[model samples]
Structure formats: structure tokens, C-alpha cells
Target: MRYAFALAAVLCASPALAQQPTAPAPGSNHDARPQFDISTGVDFERGDFGTGAQVDKIAIPLTAGVSIGSVRVSAQLPWVRVTAPANVIAPTGPLGLPILVDPTRPATRTTRQGLGDLRLGAAYDLPVQGIVASVRAAAKLPTASVDKGLGTGKADYSVGADVAKPLGAVTPYAGVTYTMAGDPEGFQLRNSFSGQAGAALRLGGSASAQLGYAYAQNPIEAGEDDQRIVGGLHADVGRSLSLGVYGSGGLSAGAPRLGGGVTLGLKFGR
Candidate 1:
């Protein structure tokens, strides 16, 4: 559950991303090592999931991991803020499992914030010829308060694989993930299939840019299909620190009309 709230300013590229390159392009395959990072960002979106509602969300995620050969393992703790039309029943959870209040009941004005589901995940990388293949798996814990509209209060899981080929400084990649969210409370959620593909271009030694598209099937029976175009840039400020900003616009009625985020990274032992 990403591409949070949408606001005019959030859609504008940030000045922080205007630095020189000191590292590889963000999101490109790289050597693994023990590291820790904390990312925080704000997003504002409208007409999310065809709810005809406006939303503002702030998310903070912290991750720490180590690599063993080509394997990497990490854990993430996430917190979020959500403000939505009380009548639309915006349910939320981690990654692909979003929860909503029982819509059959009368809705009220809603604004809530707190922890999202905690997650532990791992990834493996395999290089074949000039193409690199990768697989990832994660498990979500029921950590958020369902009454606060922060989560579905159920455990969830997802697994996916993708391959990428580097063509000089420009690399293209594609991948898909299947999410399984168990039923919680009175609602039954369907398993979701989502996919993403795009290309990333590294600019000199200090900056990189990327463009991509994402598609996801709604987990709810009547939920609208989710489709959007997303892109962003990353800039290295120094040897170990970088800044990133991204934005997305929906291509379908079921998706958010607009959404975006910014992230700051400080890499160690990379």
C-alpha cells in the first residue's frame, strides 16, 4: 500500500535531488553488504481507489540488513499517517494488503496514524550472461491497529522475481509479485498479482533517473484495477549520502490521481 497521499507540492521535484553523482543509480543492482537506513517521506493523493476522497500520508521506514554471498536479509518497521473522506472507508495495511472499515456500516470522518505491519524479508541475486535475476520474499506481522484504519490486523506474505539487463549506463528491468492476505474481521480479501517494469539511467557519477509503470489487481472483490506511471531521480550528495524524489500519476479510475515520495539514504559498508 504505497504511492500515498497526493499534493501539488509533493508532485514537484525536490531541490535535494539536484546533486552530483557519487554512487550508482538508485534501485540498480549492486554489491551487498551490512547496512542500515531510515527513510521518511510525505505523500498526498486524490481519488485513491475510486474512493472519490483525498488523502495525505506520511511514512517512515527503517531497515537494517547484511549480505551473505548473493543473499540479503533485512527487517522493516513502518509508520504511516492517513486522512481520507470518512465515507470512503480507506482501509490500509503493509505492501499489498490494504484494509478498510466494514463498508456496509455507515462511515464517519476518518484520520488515523500509527505503525503499519512490521515486515521481515530476504532477497537473492543470480547473474546469468549479461542479465541479472533476483527473487524476494517477505512476511508481514499484524502490528498496526485495525480500529485506527492503519492495517487489516492480519499476517500477510508476498514473493516475487525479476530480471534486469544493463546496457551501458542504462539498465532495464521487470518483475512481478504475488501477495496473499488472509481474511481479517468480516471481509474476504483476494490474493493480488502486481507487476512493474522500467528502465533506469545513470547520469555521470552523481545523479540517476528512472521511468517505470506499475499495475496491480485489486484485492477486494469490487475494488477497481490499479494502474499508474511512476518515475523519479536520485542524486548523490557526497560519498555515502543521497537524496531521491519520485512521483506517480494514475492511468485508471481505480488508482490514485497523483502520488509521490522523497527518500534520503546514507550508505555504509557498501
Candidate 2:
């Protein structure tokens, strides 16, 4: 459950799916060159995750990235807070497997806060006819404290590919990922697969909206699979500033009942 929550936070903090780069606003001094980007945002989610007791989570993530030619690289680190039953241990990093201290033990309210795992990722844009496509890989470094239930104490990795094609004012895209879960001391986590499909609609020259659905296989054998509907609104404010607001609603007990967040991004260099 904690793993599910952490992953949800990471997903929510990200920009909308299928969003294509748009031209700078008219009269703006935006440079048409490869650039470095930085973004930060806060995300919140609440859910029972099939457990009888409710859990709440908050994450504030900082991310930075740069594009060079057809390749892009990025890093992200987040601060996370969790409040839940004592039996429900909270793991601070994304893609962690949920671990219950004692499923049979009576639960008590508990809270944990700390820095989360560090994530590093790289991607290569694939040249394709009439479509944007990319292949990506990411790794989660175990940085949080396992003793404090802030991480799995082991690393995780994932690889995926996505493609988007523009059709008039709408861009439709789909992606699939395979994650290798880390097995902790007493737990055997299962590798999982996740996928998303979405379309982004250009609202004008500077704004767009996206709607999507996502599904993930459960990393825990006894846990329910995760499913959700997601959407977002994004806008460019100036030559180098952008804003995004997004929301999600769970379609399964494995996901947050509802979640939302805002992100602000800045771009530098030409």
C-alpha cells in the first residue's frame, strides 16, 4: 500500500501525458534551442488501498532536466509525508512494495516524514514518420531510511516506450512500462507492467488539456491491481515559464480515491 501511494505521488507530480512542445508566444523572446528545465510541485492523495484504515500522503518533488540533440536526461528527488495505521508502513520512494509490519496486529495511527528516493532517467527520441516516439529508462536509488519505513532499502528500475501522433488539434499517445521490483529481506516483490493511453487537445497557442487512463499490475500478489482516470490543464505563461494543474480519480481500491497537484516549470538556455 505504501508503495502504491508513493508511485501515485510521482505520477501525479509529472506533467500531463501526450503534451507536445508548442511554439513560444507571439512577441516573446523565447529561443528555439535545446534547453535545461527545472520544475517543482506538491501532490496529495488519500485512500484506504483495500486496508480498513485510511491513509494520507503528501509529496513535494524537485526535478531538473536537459535535452541534448535527441537525448534527454533528468533527476528527481522528493520529500514525502505519510499518515496511516501502524500496521501500514509508509515507504518514501516511488515504486516501493507495500509492507505491513504485522497484518494481524491491531493498528494504531502513525506518521512519517522524510526525504524520498532519488530517481534518475534518460530517454532517446526515435525518428519516426508522422509521429513522436521515445524510449526511456529510469532507476530509483534507495536514499530514504528503511529503519524509519521511508524506503525499501533497495533499488528499482524500469524501461518503457511511448509514441504520440498529432491529428489536427489533438495528439493521441500510448505508453507501456515494465518495472523490476526489489525484494526486501522478508518480502518477495513481483515485477509489474503498467500502461497508459491518452490524448492532448490544444486549447490555443499557449494552453492545452489532456485526458488519460492508466493501469498497473499489482506488485503484491494479494493486492488489487491499480487503475485510474487522469486529466490535466497546462499553459505557458511567458517565454520560459509554464504551469500545470492535474487530477486523478481511482477506479480500483489499489489507487487513491482522488488526487491532484500543481506544477511550475522554468526553462533556461537557448
Candidate 3:
């Protein structure tokens, strides 16, 4: 089975509110300038992955990005550690989920640690009838070593779009993504589709909360699809710093049973 502890990693990095761009003030020049941000965080998750063997994973990801006008570009790289049965593979794809290569293979718990595949992404914002919309594209580079089971040893690509509408203190949003998987030796990974729907609620002051459901098609033919409930609370510290705490619970065997993590973000430029 494919366990999505890696999905928790992605949620920890980008909260729902963070993906919504702020509109510029009327006749303001600030929106035309460039803005930069950097973020880093550690995420941990443990699950059986439906293979009758425990799997634990830790990921430390560092990301940096610049936004010019309504366009943004970013890159992320993560150090990952995985402990699982020898039949399981670590950091299998773009989301860094571990895969159960062969459940019937002899079981020997082992640990592997190394750099994960690097991901580069770009997005463009579009405002339409009071709704914030954006289109995004991303590529995963085969930077991690396949021998160490840190990646698929092939590049992957994805495209997606998101839209959010703000009403008073609440914003409702939804997004869909399509990914083209790269086949590795002895494995035929299938393309997949994923989506999320959520709402962010303002809790007064500098804090906000969000809750969402995520679903994804399983790329492996033997596993069930992935489904989970994800939520988080985020707060701004002063002007440039922000912090968030998030968690997820799996609704299917293809996802981690339970996972949570914290993240810190810093903003620069303007």
C-alpha cells in the first residue's frame, strides 16, 4: 500500500490561507514589486501502511520563493529518513511517500536516510469576480539516489489550479491536481489525480483556522485510493514571521493513520 505521510508533509509546508494571495490596494504600487519568503520545518509520521509492518518517516524540508506581480516561483529540497521493512521503498515519488514494493517479500526492518528529490514550481494568480484563482505547474528532479531508495530515479511533473472566495471572515476554496508519474525499473506507476476542498475561518487577531478533506487516486495498482482529513491553526508573529500547527487523520489504508507537525515561515523583500 501507499501511505501518505508525505501528504502531511505537503500540508505542513503550505496552509490553506497561505495559498490565497492578497489583493493590492487600489492604485497601489506595492503589488508590482517583488516579494520573497523562506520556510523550513520537520515532519514525522508513523503507520503500518497496510503491510503488517510498521513504517516511520521524518522529513526536514527547506523552501524559498519569490513572487513578482502575480507570478511566483519556488524550489524545495528535503532531508528524509525512513524506517520500514526491506520490501518497502522510501521517498518513492514527488510527495515522498514510501511504497510497499512487495508485501510478500521477506521482511527485514531497515532504515535509510538521504536527500529527497528536489521540486521546482511556478504559479500565476488570476482574480475573477471577487474570487482568487491560480494555476500552478511543478517538476520533480531526480536528485536523490535511487540506490538508496530516496527517489524514483526519474523526473515527474504536475499541473493544478485553485480557487478561493472570501466572504466576510470566511474563505472557501477548492483545488485539483493531475500528476504524471515516472516509471522506475520493475514498477509501472500510473498517473494520478488529487483534490482538496476547505475553508479558512478568521479567529480574530492574527490567528486563523482551517479544515479540509483531501483525496487522491492510488498510483499503484494493488492499493486503495488515499483519503484523509487535514486541518491546522496558523498565527502571524509580528510582521515577518508566522507559525502553524497542523494534523491529519487517514480515512483509508492508503494514508497514514495519524500525523501532525509544526512549521515556521519568514517573509522578506516586499
**Best of the candidates, lDDT:** 2
- Clashes (candidate 2): 1
In terms of TM-score, which candidate is stronger, 1 or 2?
Answer: 2
Give stretches of model 2 more than 4 Å off: 1-9, 12-34, 92-106
Q: Write the per-residue lDDT of candidate 3 for residues 1-270, one digit (tens) a residue.
A: 000012323732121211212211111122767878888776766666566677777777788988787788889887888888777765633342335465444467788888888888888776555667778788878887776666668787777777776687877767777778688777888887777777777788877777778777666777766677777777778889878777777787766677666778798786
- Looking at model 3, which ten-residue stretch has the lowest summed lDDT? 20-29
What lDDT would candidate 1 get against the real structure?
A: 0.57
Tens digits of per-residue lDDT, candidate 2, 1-270, equal 000011233553221221122211211122335678898877777877667678787778888987766777888888888788766655544442443454543477888888977888787777666667778888888887665566767888888777777787877767777778787666777887777777778789778777778777767788877677777777878989888777778798876687777778898877
C-alpha RMSD between model 1 and the true structure: 6.3
The list of candidate 3 runs beyond 4 A from truth reads 1-30, 92-98, 102-106
In model 3, residue pairs whose N, Cα or C atoms come closer than 3 Å (at least 3 residues apart or on different chains), thus clashing, are none
Per-residue lDDT of 46 in model 3: 68
Order of the predicted models by lDDT, top scorer first:
2, 3, 1
On a 0 to 1 TM-score scale, where does candidate 1 land against the true structure?
0.82
